[model samples]
Target: MNTSSTPTPESTSRLSEPVAGAPLVLPVIEEHAVVGREMVETGRVHLTKTVEEHEEALNFTLLHDEVQVERVPVNQYVADGATLPGVRYEGDTMVIPVVREVVVKRMLVVEELHITKHQVPTQESHRVVLRQESVQVTREPAPGTIIPPTASTPAS
Candidate 1:
């Protein structure tokens, strides 16, 4: 029997009676969504390499050591059974003694060499050619596709 202000399809079905000695069973319903993914190709990029040349000036100081050799003749006799004289330095000059053997079994000092050093600095200028590489990127959209506006860094 109907016992509501208005009989509805949902209420009528819920109130139906079951078979004798059989427990009443309620039905439950649930909804779900199905998801999937697809791959897509957008565009292509082209790179171009180029070289640039220019002249630049370089300025610096050049330093070098200059040697001056002066030979002084010293004809002096050494003492008998005396050890030979070793090299000695006088201030910035290096003195090297040259010795000779005489016929009387004696050692004689023939000549002395004086070596002096000096530092000379000079300024110089030179022009040199230098090369630099730069790359430019060009974008090509796929067939029947639209390209968007974007910001990018400049190549050095």
Candidate 2:
């Protein structure tokens, strides 16, 4: 009889190992969102009409009208550092880079009663006017208590 015992083979079926270059799979989720359009408000608008006509051998007629008007209060927000290519935090003080202006569009309507009287008259005209208005700006502090910067006080 042989004194030494024969070696037994070990089972590798129970062992699990990760493989390289394996694709990872994840669950997909679907959701829906509601979107709305922006709202715009317009104030009062005025209209003006004028007519003129003339003739050398016959009678001529001319009519003209003038109008002046003003609109209601319009809100305009002037933001500072709005165009900078970085994130902006709350309570950050910055100068307004652009001048906030309130403008009104106006048009003049003209009609010729007679060609001879008008004498090749020009048509309508449009213009835009900028009006200066009073603006009030206010800001609120952060929700938490205020903490002084470390640079301001000496290290303890």
Candidate 3:
């Protein structure tokens, strides 16, 4: 009788499954995060300066010089070669001496006023409006955080 060799367990398993010459390939999916800086407008600050005007009334005293003259009747007699009253300047006033031949002696009176002027410096204060500017930082998320699909990406 013709008979073949008996098959072992190892040989039977090898026949049932195919053997691969190369290693198997698998797809891997990974998520990546990109970080960058971008400039954006958040808020604005404004400053303003204003000027104010006001009126004030002040009262003060001023001094000035004045001169007055008066005439009186004098009855007197003076001899020759005698010196009479003369004109002279005192401070800021002019004085004149008068003499006449009269029957009797008389008296005369004169009045005058002298004044000096000087400049006085004074300091004054007023209110004004002042303004300043400052910057405020605000954190805001970007418009869209989701990344757009690219051509290389597989569609879901």
Candidate 4:
């Protein structure tokens, strides 16, 4: 038997071919641009006269007074029970001797005041008052000195 090979006509025609371009075209789109601005507002200024008027309209008055008085009494008594002997009661007025003691007291007074103003011409004022009694002290001999008695020194 004999073997032989050969190309078919239908296979040669299918290999010789090229593709064509597309028939439709796409559309283009445009976007809009935006601009922005910032806004700011101013604040009101403070008025001193308005504040003063408001304070005066709402102002309240208050008054106060304080007085202090003290009364002290001094009495004397006997040193020993033998001075008024044979007394029946413990505090018998008849048996007790009435001796009086004299007392000297010093007095002082102090006062203070304050004032303040604002808005329509501000002013501040303060005052202090003090009252006191005068005291006189006298000494016969100077302090820190000792003198020997020659013939004139007397016992106090």
Per-candidate TM-scores read 0.58, 0.15, 0.31, 0.19
lDDT by residue (43-69, candidate 1, tens digit) is: 778999999999999999999999999
Tens digit of per-residue lDDT, candidate 2, span 1-156: 234566333333343333477665555789999999885433333444434343224234445543322232324343443442222222422222222333432221121111111123334444444344444444434446464666767789
* Model 4 misplaced stretches (Cα beyond 4 Å): 1-22, 32-35, 38-77, 81-156
lDDT of 3 by residue, 1-156 (tens): 224588666665533333477555555879999999998744344545454445554445555544455443443444445566456666655555565444344332232223323444455455554445555555444555444566686789
**Residue pairs with backbone atoms closer than 3 Å in model 2 (clashes):** 54-117
Candidate numbers, best lDDT first, in rank order: 1, 3, 2, 4
Q: Which clashing pairs does model 4 show?
A: none
lDDT of 2: 0.37
Clashing residue pairs in candidate 1 are: none
Clash numbers, per candidate: 0, 1, 2, 0
Q: After superposition, how far is residue 84 of candidate 4 from its true place, in Å?
A: 15
Rank by TM-score (best first): 1, 3, 4, 2
lDDT over C-alpha atoms for residue 35 of model 4: 91
| Model 4 Cα shift for residue 68 (angstroms) | 9.6
